[model samples]
Target: MLVILVALLWFTTVEASHCSIMARLSLMRNISELSQNNYGRPDLSHTTIVGSVLHGIKEIEVWLQNFAPGSSTPIHRHSCEEVFVIVKGQGTLYLTPSSHSKYPGNPQEFHIFPNSTFYVPVNDAHQVYSLP
Candidate 1:
């Protein structure tokens, strides 16, 4: 009985490992193919970063959004951390904590310029606006 139980567990573990390996291979293949495809179009407003995501890693979505004189992203939360970098004009970030705070729902503003990168923690609701 001991031998049989051990054999079953061993086979299950081996099979699971094999499956994971195969999944990783497939993901790598897909990411490679997508990288070869045309990701977006050129525009004066903003451009998208081509192939921003890698297969098997879905924690974050990367984009290069160009705002007109005034543009912004919607307020929302991510399952994982979200990050942004300013590749162009000046912008402002507005953040409000989802919990109680000493400021009591006051908004904090960050002035961002070209080549600045910022990270927002997961589950924090926030918004962004571009300035002329």
Candidate 2:
């Protein structure tokens, strides 16, 4: 199983005219203590730490994702970049850079370990799988 800390920043044309001067702090808790959901994917669950749903932060979303052995996220893409900070366990990232292509091409595989960090470019197809 693997536990990954994902920090996703959304780019938008709308700018924050007034930034909050007040700072916010989030206390880290046990993964089981935080609210989590699979979003319909089996063996994979995620807890949102900072995002529009919780902290009302419009520009960024932080999540803690847990994957059981042999589990993976669906092949997906987003308009905004997605970054991952590996906290524990090992996994493989399948990435296909197809920003301009009509269909996704072959994917490049990358191995990830603890303490490593990686980012997915905007609109690229990617999937993450946890090794048993």
Candidate 3:
């Protein structure tokens, strides 16, 4: 299991009996039914994002991305750390030392297979390149 500490967000509410402050979410989520969003890069036409907001995941966010062969995303960074899981297919994971435009110089590559899990640190630039 890939557990990520994307970020710590604190939510406060006024004391009220109408709401169960300790209520937690315990339900099954279907990937097929989840909404998918496109990546920022237009060339990443082969990539789609499956994202959602869950009840118990207050301080964290979770989602899945689908990549087709030859699909690649531009080097990018996020304020929060990212977690990746190769649930299916094969791909190449790319990492660079810098987040600048000329970054990814001397980039590191990794072979990604199904059931594999990887992570990118906060503000660390990285990209994914899909393979056949």
Candidate 4:
């Protein structure tokens, strides 16, 4: 009788552990599905990211952004080359040539849509604005 009782208790404990693991796996799957479906969610811009320096050879990051009409970035130069992938709306890019300073040329407006990207060379001074 004592041996039979011990065996039943052991079986129940093992089954409970398996149930808990399965529950955790189901939660993880749901999170992954939500991320895939909501890649362009508006809420993404509200989250702030603290800056940190990376020590490795390569680093990658993804960001979602929304620019209000007439919004602009200050003229700045980048030490590293930069790329901007437009996910929506129309905007303007101000690119300066080597011979000119103080925003060099007239603003170039681009009608960029989803799935488009542009690259700027290093040391290029530029500013960007969204048309109202």
Query: 69, model 1: CA deviation in Å?
Result: 1.5
Tens digit per residue, CA lDDT, model 2, 4-120: 999888654454333341234354546567788898887987898765534546788889999999998888998888999999999999999975588767999999899999999
User: Between candidates 1 and 3, which one is better according to TM-score?
Assistant: 3
Q: What is the per-residue lDDT of model 1 for residues 1-132, given as tens digits with 9 covering 90 to 100? A: 000000000112122343444465553233223322223422223322322132223222344455555656677655455666566677788877652344537667888777777766655667777675
Best by lDDT: 2
Per-model TM against the reference: 0.53, 0.78, 0.59, 0.48
lDDT of 3 by residue, 13-126 (tens): 423332242254225656466554555643332212211233433444455555557776577877666777667777787876555555546768888777787887666678
- On TM-score, the stronger of 1 and 4 is 1
The stretch of ten residues in a row with the least summed lDDT in candidate 2 is: 16-25
Winner on TM-score (2 vs 3): 2
1-132, model 4: which lDDT tens digit per residue?
Answer: 000000000112122343444454432223123222223543223211111111111233233345566665568875555667665666677776551455556544555445556765666677766666
Q: Which stretches of candidate 3 lie over 4 Å from their true place?
A: 1-28, 39-57, 98-105
- Candidate 2: which pairs clash? none
lDDT per prediction?
0.48, 0.82, 0.55, 0.44
Which candidate order results from sorting by TM-score in descending order? 2, 3, 1, 4
Model 4, CA-based lDDT: 0.44
